[model samples]
Target: MEELLKTLNNIRSLRLLAKEIPLEQLETILKKFELVVQERKEEEEAQQLVLAAHQEKIEKYKELLKSEGISPEELLEVMNLHRFNPSQHKKRAPRPAKYKYTDLDGSQKTWTGQGRTPKAIQIQLDKGVTLESFEI
Candidate 1:
C-alpha cells in the first residue's frame, strides 16, 4: 500500500512537471505510457490463445472417454470412492469458551461473544466493571 502511494505521488509530480517542461519531453513520457498499454494488450491476446488450446485438448479427451464406453457420471463415481477429500480431512475451528459470570452456587456461566449481551453480563456492565474483568 505504501509503495502504491509513492508511485501515485510520483505520477502526480510528473503530471505537474509536464506543464512547465518542453513539449518534446512531455510527448516522450506520454509515448512510454502508450507503449506499456500496447504490451499488456499483446500479452492478453497470447493468454487467450493458450486458454483456447487447453479447452480443445480437454474436449478431445472427453471424446476419447466416450468412445471407450465411459460417461462423466461413471468417472465421477470411480473418483469419489478413492479421491482425497479435503473437507472430510479438515479439522473444525476450535471455539474458545467465554465464561463471563457465575451463579451463587458457583456454576460456570458462558457466552458465545455475539449478538445481544447476556442479562447476567449486562448486570455487571450496569454496575460499571467490564466483561473482560470476568473472562475465564
Candidate 2:
C-alpha cells in the first residue's frame, strides 16, 4: 500500500511538473522524443533483418552438414579437443630492452619501444638523434 501511494505521488508530481513546462517547449521535446523512437525502431528492424539472414545462412550450413553425415556436436567436440591453452590468449609484455644506448657518463639506458620516452632518451631525441642509433 505504501509503495502504491509513493507511485501515485510520483505520477502526480510529474503531471504537475509537466503543466508548469511551456506548451511550445513540451511539443518540441515530444517531437524530438518521437523522432528518437522512430530511429530506434528503424535500427532494430535493420538488425532483425541482418540476424534473420545470418540465421538462414546457419540453417543452410547445418543442412549441408546433415547431408554429409556430420552433426554439429561432433564438430564442437573436434574443435574442443584442439583448443589452445588459456595462457596463450593472454597479451605478452614487451621486453624491457628493445633498444640500448649509452649516456655521456657511459651509463646505459634501455627502452622497450613502448610508453613515454625516458628523460635520457628524450634528450637525445630532442637533439634529433636517430632512433636507429640506439638499436639493439
The TM-scores of all predictions, comma-separated, are 0.48, 0.51
Per residue, candidate 1 scores C-alpha lDDT tens digits across 1-136 of 9875665469786666667889998789779979998999999999999999999999998999999999989998999989888877979786776755775467767776777787777877898988788777
After TM-score superposition, the amount by which residue 66's alpha carbon in candidate 1 deviates from its true location, in angstroms, is 1.6
Per-residue alpha-carbon lDDT of model 2 for 11-127, expressed as tens digits? 786577678889998789889979999999999999999999999999999999999999999999999878997866888876768889776687987888888877777888899
Clashing pairs in 1: none
Q: Whole-model lDDT for model 1 versus the true structure?
A: 0.82
lDDT (Cα atoms) of all candidates against the true structure: 0.82, 0.86
Candidate 2 ranges beyond 4 A from true positions:
1-11, 86-136
How far out, in Å, is residue 37 in model 2?
0.8
